[model samples]
Target: MPASLTIQLVNQSTSENVYAYITGLAIQHGMARVFLKADGTSLYFPGPPPAGKILQPLTENCAIPLGPPGNTVTATIPQMAGGRIWFSVDDKLTFLRNPGGPGGGAALVEPSVLNPSDPNADVDFAFCEFTLNNDQLFANISYVDFVPRLPIALTLQTHGGAVQHVSGMPPDGLDKPQTVLRINTQSAHGTLKGTVPAASPNQLVIGGEAFARPTTADILGCNSGPFATGGGGGASAVRNAIIPRLAAAFQRGCVAAADVSEHPSHPETFYRAGGPANHYARIVHECNLDGKGYAFAYDDVQPDGGEDQSGKVNAGDPRVLVVAVGGGGAPVRITSTFTFGNTSMIKLAEVA
Candidate 1:
């Protein structure tokens, strides 16, 4: 767990994909995706502060910004001849720095902000994902949470579009690509925690081929339905959603729903401590990730038709999520908007 988790890395791919690199449990504790290029240059996704925000569902494409010259970053993999003891990331990612801090709560300093002038000490953020070859994707550590090591699980679902592998590495095509992640997560950890296919609880051993395939009910969009909402008429109504699919597998046609309750008297849970807007409200989404208790609150302000605080939540505006989660344990909120172009696909990340 060195400050950088520095290791002798290697990429076995002939063609470089954006996600092809070793990720680390970064100083921030979030998953950071690191990409090492054939040329000694690298690009880390979900870049650092200011330039990049932490990786969340729907918002995982941000890469560290390059300077005017752009080639400021440099990276290369090692060449081990005899049976390369490949150095990749491990599950119990304990990232420690030069000072050597405590377990999870602590982190390596993320740099004194991104200053192009002071390029001598630039910190490369990691922890999201890495795409070495178009065929595969591995997690790049971002931020880590130090607490009771309860099993972590996530459910991601999208509308219409299903998973289509470009290189076709995963033998037969999977109806639900997200559930296929069980094989990946199990590969990382021994016990079967995720949406494992059939075969009793922890029956499947750690190694070897994936135990089973999802039943017809396990297909991606097969068990999904249109989004459900409570308020906002056409405006407050949900134009679309990035529904959570964890519960969709066996819930029998319940594709997750969003409940928008506008309160002029923003309650404690709905209230955003200190934000740009003087007012606040809540947008409830049942992601089924960790049940209703861990559901995120999409913080937002109502519509008044003004430049900054203007929305037609009751009419034609759509409320979109700006910051997915409002700190931990707080209910998710939503921003009210009238523009049809505002609401787009929901961002749902099915974490391992």
Candidate 2:
């Protein structure tokens, strides 16, 4: 793989104030927290804030303006992991630096939807996750959080004349999901539980382990109840193995007799009516043009030869990645004429 990858950010939205921010751990630089400087090629590493301080503002501007609609801004980035390309419309996102605890390092505090008091609460925004390393470039559109008004589409062009495209939602698709999700949630509450005889109305018995029924919020967030890991820790082995089958079962609305834990290997079996289903997830997938994209935490889990519902595109020969925002647009084609250089600082006053 090349030392760095080129990403073309296209502002296809009607808003003129669309800004893109890149943040992740730089693999080449000792895994330091790196943010692309406003120049789009240079990198910004925030220093540690004062001890005991919280929500400290960044020392430099990291928002890369994409200009007006039909415009594209090219950015270069080194190999990184746990990376995200964040987009906001008509407003700049507030990113804070949090001091590290004992034996830990400082961390970047991105925008949060669950916190009502968050600085970027009122902004319309969305993000996509990625990891580019020596092996390959893996990227995907994530909906693990609440969906934003700004829909994102991705196009990855490999060097060997291959193209992969993921068309996100259309401009008028937001209202459709809202209406369908509300109806689904209301139906789930009034319906009966699963048909498994060994399972209770509120519990599922998988391999002798009992999983409590998840609340409506738990089903949507995929972060609490049966989906939760220990407080702030990684998921356990058992949880990881059970969640996908369990979730697939809920969406399919039945269990297999031989392996009560066995879930359907096909995507067509999920989210059927007349059974309890994650309507939120079902609605999100339906809203996408390709019926692909991450609707839940374990959405990537699929049986051998099964279709990928997680909406990911990756290749070891990635030539360019095109991220088009604002939903509706012709697919972006990869261009080879783009070049990259060092980042020159842009004063906050000039842009703010």
Candidate 3:
């Protein structure tokens, strides 16, 4: 892969203040916390602040504005790991610099949806995750956090004439008011009543293995209690992998223990009637035109040859990465034609 990737951001919303922010650990630069400068080409590495919890303004303007609706902005990004492209609608997001980070590097204080006091709390925003390295470029649209108002789509054009696309939510998919299906918790609990261990109400024995059931909050967060994957061995290791599958199974109401133990199971084996299903996830997946994107923490777990349900696009020889945001209207379309050695051709078209 190239040292840097070309990213084109297209604003498909009516708002003229759409802004994009890119942040990641520069793999070629000592894995320092890096952000794309306002120029959209240069890199900015922030210095460590004196203390923690105090929000310090960035020394450099890193917010790359996308101009008005129907406008497209181009940016260059270096090889980075754990990278994110954040977009805000009608507002500029607040990203602060703080102390106490890995390798003595500064920690980035990003916008948060859970924090009510966060400066970007009222802002409408979303992001996509990616990792570009010497091997390949892996990118995916995530909904691990709360869903955003804006929709995002991805298109990857590779050098081998292969194109991979993830069609996210349509411009008005979620915004349109409509009656939605709701999952009944009582029905879901009844399905797992048989798995409850006689000795422990908080634990369920499935396939002769005891698994701790997380709280309602923990299930939603996938971060605490039984969902937490603490570093260790023995049962912890076993829980690390099986717990997620079990949680997914319970929510999806998988009938057989074999279906829960065997990951990446066929999609048809999940979310059956008379079973407890993650209704939010089911609705989110249905909202997306391609029926892709992460609806839950374990949504990516699939059978070896099973089709991928997560919305992801990746390539070893990525030519261009186009990200469409603010799905307010018809999405734009771009096409390119090229040859290997002697000749090449490129074309761009926007469909209204």
**Best lDDT among the predictions, by candidate number:** 3
For 95-173, candidate 3 gives per-residue lDDT tens digits of 8888865557778899998887999988889999999999999999998986677888899999999999998887853
Q: What stretches of model 2 exceed 4 Å from their correct place?
A: 101-105, 177-352
Q: Who is ahead in lDDT, 1 or 2?
A: 2
Task: Output the TM-score of candidate 3.
Answer: 0.52
Ranking by lDDT: 3, 2, 1
lDDT of 2 at 135: 99
Q: Write the residue-wise lDDT of candidate 1 on 1-352 in tens digits.
A: 1122222222222213222133333323333332333233443333333223222121232222222221232343222111011111111111212222233222233222234443222222222223222232222322242111111111222244654322211221112122222211212332222333355642222223222323322323322222222334531211211112222211222111112121111122232332212121122222323322322222122122312112213436744444445445333443332435764544433333
Error of 1 at 60 (Å): 22
What C-alpha lDDT does candidate 1 achieve relative to the native structure?
Answer: 0.26
Candidate 3 global lDDT = 0.74
**Which 10-residue window in model 2 sums to the lowest lDDT?**
177-186
Clashes of 2: 0
Count of clashes, each model: 45, 0, 5
